[model samples]
Target: MTKPKTQEPVITSTSELPTSEAKWVTLRKVNYTDQTGAARTWEVASRKTRAKSAGVDAVAMGNVILHPARAPATVVVIQYRPPLDAYTVEWPAGLIDEGESAEDAAVREFKEEIGYDCEVTSVSPVQAADPGMSDANMKLVMVEVKLGEEDGEELPVQRLEDGEHIQRVVVPLTELYQRLVEWSEGERKIVAAKLFHFAAGMEFARKEGKKYGL
Candidate 1:
């Protein structure tokens, strides 16, 4: 069967709205007294879908793909971000369902986005997604996926939703940071901050290890 070509999403127009009219995310003015005793009001955006059971708005998967003879790799997804009106390279992520846990959300999102089942290895504490701009928070869930020799070169089919046109890129662990940087420059793509920070941290640790002979 021939698959239908995906169309690139474009913003036809943009407009401003009062906070009260927002559905998915709402803006708020936080009033508080500063350390110096001056009153302050800060504007912030908050997600209306934050699940109390999940204790977070979202979960991003830090997936490590293990192969018998190849270097370990990770999956990064590229998709159009409407707010930015640009394609973004980001960790496979999704909102946590009302009744789901972080680990479950990680596994489900990884499968839906990357087409690989993963084992949740660790879950980071809830972290701010954009502290200065929004009150949205997410947890980084580290997961591992093992691939058989036959599956090494084949890309699995993604189980994405109708409007989700995601392209998955498998990147070797050692080359991730450089690869992301190259993608950002060469393709003029937006890289998600959390994903960039993760790659940068790994690269930093690797360089430090070599420097100290660890």
Candidate 2:
């Protein structure tokens, strides 16, 4: 089969966004008190699409797809992130629709972005996404996808929405950290903070475990 061609998106122009016209995000001048009771003000960018029923803004799926004949692997998404004007290596994630639970969002996003049906194994507590910059918070939902021998190694076709151009890469869990590092350097792609941290943490634990004979 032939592969489809893709081009890097071009930027036509840029301008400051007016707060009144902003739909997805907004700028805020926050006021607060420090540890010493000192008054302070800081500029911050905030998301305007957080659903009140969801509580948290989004969910990043920590996917583990197990094949009967092969080692367990995870799928990561490579998509163009306009803010950086470059592609990013990130977990399959998406905003929780109104009244949608984190688990449902994770499952839906995984199917849409990676074309896999997964079962939610666990869900993390609400955690900050970028505390220093935005008030965005998210949950890390651990999901497992079981593949039968008949399924083969090929991933299913993605069901992405319009305007979405994402590439999915499946990597063994043991090689995930190294792969992310190589992709970041070789492809000159930005690594999303949450994804990078998760990979780094796994690598760190593996190294410590070996050193401690764990």
Candidate 3:
């Protein structure tokens, strides 16, 4: 008699996986059938805030702040990211509060992280942070601010949260791309995608004499 072969289990749906307790984040495992209908399993890391939301998860916001001065400049922040165990250079960003819009969240984060009260000039469509791994989304807001002697006001002070430690870095508009390139080659440094995209648009606009949506 010939020996019989065992059939593999087919996964038709996803479910949450058991994980250790964490305050800000959680992990889940999903099971599904791929395009070829093969059973597959994947793990996802999600923000606890989104998981705990009553209805739909709130979108996050980031600001691309431009300071109009004798020499045009843009603002970014350097802060420690626990996951990477390194400092990340990113735009001012935060999650939208329950009753706030993306523009409102952008303004609040700008004040909290960079200490600047800026006028929001434009807001971009929502973009996924990482579709393959996370469901996080954020809108990039363009803010025009007058800094230094241009606005006739003193330097703004950061209003960071209790556990936050952020440092402001200003890059000259002309050198924004160059600085990004340098940072890309540096050690233990990660640049936010939104910042890179915004800077690239600005650079393109400068070369082509076309406005890239501010």
Tens-place lDDT digits, model 2, residues 1-214: 7856777787778899899999999999999999999999998988999989988999999999898889889999998888888899999999999989999999999999999889999999999988898898999999999998899878899998988999898899999999988888955498898999999989989989788776
Clashes of each: 0, 0, 0
Assess candidate 2 and give its lDDT.
0.91
Question: lDDT for each of the candidates?
Answer: 0.89, 0.91, 0.69
lDDT of 1 by residue, 1-214 (tens): 9988767677899999777888899988899999999999999989999888878999999889999989999989988899888889999999999999999999898988888889999999989988999999999999999888877567788898987889888889989999989888955479999999988888888888788776
Error of 3 at 19 (Å): 1.9
Error at 47, model 3, angstroms: 1.1
Q: For candidate 3, report its TM-score.
A: 0.72
Q: Pick the candidate with the highest lDDT.
A: 2
- How many backbone clashes are present in model 3? 0
Assess candidate 3 and give its lDDT: 0.69
